[model samples]
Target: MTTHPAPTVHDVRHEETGEGQPTTGLDAFAVCALSGAYSAVAEARRFTAAILEGWGVCAPVVSDAVLVVSELTGNALRHAAPRGPDAAESRPDLVCAAWLALAHQEAGVLCAVSDSSRAVPALAAPDLMAEEGRGLWIIDRLSESWGWTRPDHTGKTVWAQLPVPRPTR
Candidate 1:
């Protein structure tokens, strides 16, 4: 068996400010295999939770935010596999990457997932009979608003905004 190089974090950017102030943001990125690995998902969730917590997010909202990351990561893993096993082994440089951005906007936290896949995500039709195909739909219902941005033909970033909880007097 061959060994795969561990993923590395790159291009991390962050910003923060007081509540009722201008938008602040935090972003983390990693490059890893498209295989269905628990470690990859766990790391992504942990990183996301950390960023949200650092930005003074509540526990419940942070949990939900992590779920969004999981969904997006799962989608990337399912769709963005390398050409073949040998191709992956011979050239690890083509590995798929996951980019998570948590931005504090006037309305809420904008969570964005960027991947090295060209395919765009869509909400599947409601199907009580089906067991799968509802990730985007669930994201839409949970988030205030969501969309995708394709800066180039090679990749796209899907983002969703979760409203901040109103403070109690």
Candidate 2:
């Protein structure tokens, strides 16, 4: 199996205060690099939960968020490995690298997992006893809204937005 490096995450935000200076806001964002390994799914799940908790997202939503992250990240790793087209120049000869981002929106939390493929995900009718092919189904049912987008940079991103309980970090 080939391994790729995880990218460093960065955040840039603009905020304001009473005197238009700076004040804390409810919005939050976090990102992490993911390798196309099976274990990255678990890491995605844990990362989602941690970010939600840190942002004071309620417990029930946090659980759902974890599941969403796991499913999307798993699917990306499964399908987008051994990078083909739209490979970044800086990271050429890539076996496959991915990224996961979580943003705390005013109405809900948005979780996105992006990989090096433009293929869209569809709901698969897996056998009742089957262990695989249920990721998209779970994401559809749990999230308030979900969709996939092909970014200008490279590959596609599968995203799920979950409505979180109002609270503070």
RMSD of 1: 9.3
List lDDT for all candidates, in order: 0.64, 0.77
lDDT of 1 by residue, 67-130 (tens): 8777776666566544444746744655445556667655677677666667777676668778
Clashes per prediction?
A: 0, 0
Q: How far off is residue 68 in model 1, in Å?
A: 1.4
* Lowest lDDT block of 10, candidate 1: 1-10
RMSD of each: 9.3, 7.9
Off by over 4 Å in 1: 1-38, 87-96
Candidate 1's displacement at residue 35, Å, is: 8.4
| Candidate 2 similarity to native, TM-score | 0.74
The most accurate candidate by TM-score is 2
